[model samples]
Target: MGIELITLLIVVALLGLMAFGVPLGITTLTVSLVTAILCFGERAGFFIVAANVSEVLHKYELIAVPFFVFMANVLERSGIAKSLFDSMAIAGGRFRGSVGVQTCIVAVLLAAMSGIMGGEIVMLGLIALPQMLRLGYDKKLSIGIICAAGALATLIPPSVVLIVYGLAAQVSITKLFAASAVPGLLLASLYITYILVRVRLRPGMAPIYDIPETGYPFFKRLKFLKGIILPAVLTFTVLGVIYSGIATVTEAAAIGAVGALVVAGVRKEACSSP
Candidate 1:
């Protein structure tokens, strides 16, 4: 068979395997293994696979993956996102769909911190969903906002998707992060704008609701400032170091991971306090 025909068959087999509920990684591996065995001798196929695996393992870029994942998990566990949500809820002002707007803001902040959509979704579902429902937000609008805004994690900085793409394409991860920033923010703006417009046009979808005051002393309200500081430091330390040529991608990832841990620790302590 021609090379194109062989590739087509492999893709078809991959799709079939995935359709059967096989894990995606396993399905891809199986398809590639079969294709290699068919195209080359069994011994050559084994050697080729081994060589590719070694190459992948040896790539320095792969080191960033674990650091990013660690940073994301630590941030998720921290109370930083909740603080941001509270701050944003106040900042959103008293208007129809204000909480929904704040929910999108929370999703953006969580995405910037976590770089994983699932965490944002879970966080919002736990925090924002009940609040929105209690406030009589339209079910469709509430759910849609959570799902759509949470998905921004994929395109933002510290994203695992961009890291993997950089590794596979032999591009600079730092550059990818910098280049993706504008587009990610643009996409987020679009989401926020759409949400606001929708709420405005269909006021029934999101109604104005009471937002309780912090009821804290003037000094205590500074917790909201903490919500913004850590994320700004993280974004700057990670992307800034890379973009400014102060550190390599791996080094930046390391810095970001440590920073995230420190932030999480501080937030944990703060939450533990009265």
Candidate 2:
């Protein structure tokens, strides 16, 4: 068959399989295997498929993705997100839309640690969303902040998406991380600026976050920094090792996973103490 006709048939088959509700991954794999067997004999086709799968499995950078994912899960279960939220909220003080602004800040920190959007969004939704609502922030504003901030994971350093792209394109993951860092923070800054502007234009959209701790002076609020120190240390440890050339992305991800467990252990110990 002509290559053009083959391509057309593949597209039609994919669409038909998807329409029938076959999972995308399974459908694509099945179609590719069948196509290979038709084009080459069965033995060669199976060997080709196995070789391709083995090649992907052997990419060192690919290991980072799962390590980062595991780190995210560990941090999530350890209650670090709640701590970061509480610290940022109190440290930011009583400005209008302070909670939303702090949510953005917390999201950035979470993205730095996790490098996964879904987990960060879930953490914010579980922790920040209700707090904003309780403080009488507008629902749309609250939801928008969570979503926009959560997506920063995809652009931040140690991003799983970037790792996969680097492996596929044969580029340096470190360079990709470096290129994305500024853009990610820029987006975060835009989010913060929008929240502040929106609240200024319509004060009722975000009631000032009021609590006794917020009434404290800036110097007094330094103690709240304790809540964020572990996360900052973990992020710095992982990214520092990568950027400083002390480790590759996979090694840094392993470090991050271990660091997460240590942080969780420390938190657990502190809670149980006294």
Candidate 3:
């Protein structure tokens, strides 16, 4: 068959498989394998497929993905996200849409620490979503904020997406992370600014997050900042090692995983102590 016809057939096959509800990964793998077998003999096709898979598997930077993912899970289950949310809320003080703004900040911090979108979104949904709702914020606003802010994980430093891309494109992961940092923060700043402006104009879209702690003097609330310490340390450790040239991206990722476990252990001990 002509190459054009073969390409069209492969596209059609992919869509058809997806329409039938096959997972994207499986569908792509199946189509590629079938195409290879048809283009080359069975033995040659299998060899090509194995070689490609093995090549990807052997990439050193690819190792970062699981380590980052594990760190995300550890932080998720450790109750650190909840603490970060609470601390940021109290630290933000009384203001219209304060919870929403705090949620955005927490999302950025979480993104910095984890670099995984699903985990960041899940953490926000579980911890921040209900709080925003209970505070009388608009339903659509709350959901939108969580989703938009959580997606920063894809752009922020130490992002697994960038790691994989760097490996595939043969680019520098460090430079990619540095290049993305400003854009990610700028997006976050925009989210916060929008929240502040929206609530200021609408007045009813987001209620002020009022509580006893919020009533405290601003400086006195500084103690609540303790909640962010571990996340900050972990972020510093991972990014610091990478940017300082002390370790490669994969090694930094391994450090992050270990730091996550240590943070979890410390939090568990603290909770169990009293």
Return the lDDT, model 1, position 194.
90
Q: Which stretches of candidate 3 lie over 4 Å from their true place?
A: 1-24, 27-50
Q: Write the per-residue lDDT of candidate 2 for residues 166-240, one digit (tens) a residue.
A: 887889999999999999999999999999999999999999888999999999998997989999999999999
Q: Where does candidate 2 stray beyond 4 Å?
A: 1-53
lDDT of 2: 0.93
Given candidate 3, what's the lDDT at residue 257?
A: 95
Clashing pairs in 3: none
Most accurate candidate by TM-score? 3
Poorly placed runs, candidate 1 (over 4 Å): 1-21, 34-49, 214-225
The superposed Cα distance between candidate 2 and the true structure at residue 167, in angstroms, equals 0.5
Cα lDDT, model 3, residue 205: 94
Question: Which is the winner by TM-score between candidate 1 and candidate 2?
Answer: 2
Q: What is the lDDT of residue 221 in candidate 2?
A: 95
Where is the poorest 10-residue window by lDDT in model 3?
A: 160-169
TM-score of each: 0.82, 0.85, 0.87
Per-residue error for 181 in candidate 1, Å, reads: 1.0
